[model samples]
Target: MAVAATKEPNRLILFTDAVVAIAVTLLVLPLVDVVPEVAREHRPATEVITGHQPEIWTFLLSFAVIIRLWLSHHKAFQHVRAYSTPLVLCNSAWLLAIVVLPFPTEMVGVFDNSRFTTGLYIGTVFVATGLQAAMYLIIRIDPEVASEDTPLPGEFVLGAVTAAVLLLLALVVALTVPGVGYWALLLLLLSGPVEWAWRRRHAVAAA
Candidate 1:
């Protein structure tokens, strides 16, 4: 049988980091453009920030989201020394979702809170989180990607899956619940407890 080829993960990790940095930076450009308008109107410097509260809020939220996603990606790949074709494809799709996040984030500030805008923002997050979860699962199952001596922890895999599930739940609540808006994302807080319970249950079962 012909063995599949695998390469070191360094270049892939570097490229992913670069793309995530650019995406996070893009989230702030809309807010920066507001400064020129504030100056052109001879408005007080205070208004430069105070008047663009929506833009600023969206920028901060998306910045945090991207950062969290990047951290998750980092953790998922931490033990992965080799990259297969499937892992590369999955990581590329995850990056594409990260790149697209800034657009909906900008729209959230420009448009009134509604089903479509809320859905779009939450949906983008859902896709990104879901992809990250898939990466965790892939690394756990693919012997070529992670060394047997340093396999991904079952808790980390469960946490990633739990987070993705919570994000999906948040997306559904945001879309179906009237006036919920971004508040639906609070559902993510349950991820810790949920993952804990799942892990504990499995441990007990094995015992």
Candidate 2:
């Protein structure tokens, strides 16, 4: 029991990392539809492969995004000194979001420039961010598993929430416009500055 108790955090991180790694691997697999059956019948494989530049770019973009999430997960786990059943459950929910990332990425690759696929991709990010932020908050909420260090997890939590709201606003642009919905993701770039200002405000008020 003591050995298991001491190793809980390690187990969580290991499992989460494995899941994230698999998701990242799958993120690129959809792009490999380089030579479709039709293309094989009509043209050389080389020419058909060259035609998938857009899919390649999409895979690169999605791989970068999911890696960012993985980094965020690592950073959040750094402050976690222990865990409990609730923490495990909450982290499971967050991991579930991460695991689903490759699906929408593949969907976006298959679908035309439609609101449904773009929105689905963006919505996946929003949910993953929200659940991640909630995971950090859960550590703070239940004192039974909290460590001596408070982890100031709100930094990551609020940062993700801020980006999610920005994504929401950007989705409006997506709905109103056409062929430009993905551009809305750029709004997430504001998260760093927003989180900085938020932390500063709290630091000042607490002083």
Candidate 3:
């Protein structure tokens, strides 16, 4: 008799998707309190919208970042056949940071001038990126969990670690240079493309 081959559910991917969706939706919840009178009295609807503009920027940036993070995780995890307890726990830590981003976004919008506020926001992103890096390390150590033919790419691993380190550095820089930190966010947003470019350059050189 042949033994049955069981398929493991990619629970991390599913849970991450659910949490990201909820977090993105929660980002908009802060805007619901701007009543009609508040809009009219504060300024026109447009100005009121614009006044809370940081909220919009933060929400959009955070939402898109979270979505992209999930996409990357999904791609990376596709190689994995099973996850260990530590990997799952590290992922949860990452998700905790993701879920907490909204609080910092709201705080920054409320007190955009506060240095500590910006630090907190950047710190949250740093923590998320760090956990993601940790997860990658665990996956690399246990290639047996990965698909046999889909060995993790060296470029992918390098890129993940580089981006995580850059994010951590950006968090530290944010403490002194808040404006630079915002610009760094734009740079961090381009990590995927940067990683692709790096791999392409290496391939061309090898050829």
TM-score of each: 0.95, 0.83, 0.81
Candidate 1: tens digits of C-alpha lDDT, residues 8-126: 78899999999999999899899889889989999999998888788788889899989988987888788797888778888999999999999999999889587899899999988
- Ten contiguous residues minimizing lDDT sum, candidate 3: 1-10
**Runs in model 2 lying further than 4 Å from the true structure:** 1-7, 35-39, 42-49, 176-179, 203-207
Instruction: Rank the models by TM-score, top first.
Output: 1, 2, 3
lDDT of each: 0.87, 0.75, 0.74
Pick the TM-score winner: 1
Model 1 worst lDDT run, 10 consecutive residues = 1-10
Clashing pairs in 2: none
Candidate 2 lDDT, 1-207, residue by residue in tens: 333334458878998999889888887766555557536678766665576666777788878888888898788777777877767876788778878878887777778568998888888777877777777786656555556565545656787678778777777777677778798888778878888888899899999
Tens-digit lDDT track of model 3 for 1-207: 111112353666788889988988898887776556466586777765766788777778777778777777777887777766777788889889989988998887778746688778878878887788788877777654555787666655777777887787767776677466465555576678877788889899999
Runs in model 3 lying further than 4 Å from the true structure: 1-7, 35-43, 178-181, 186-207
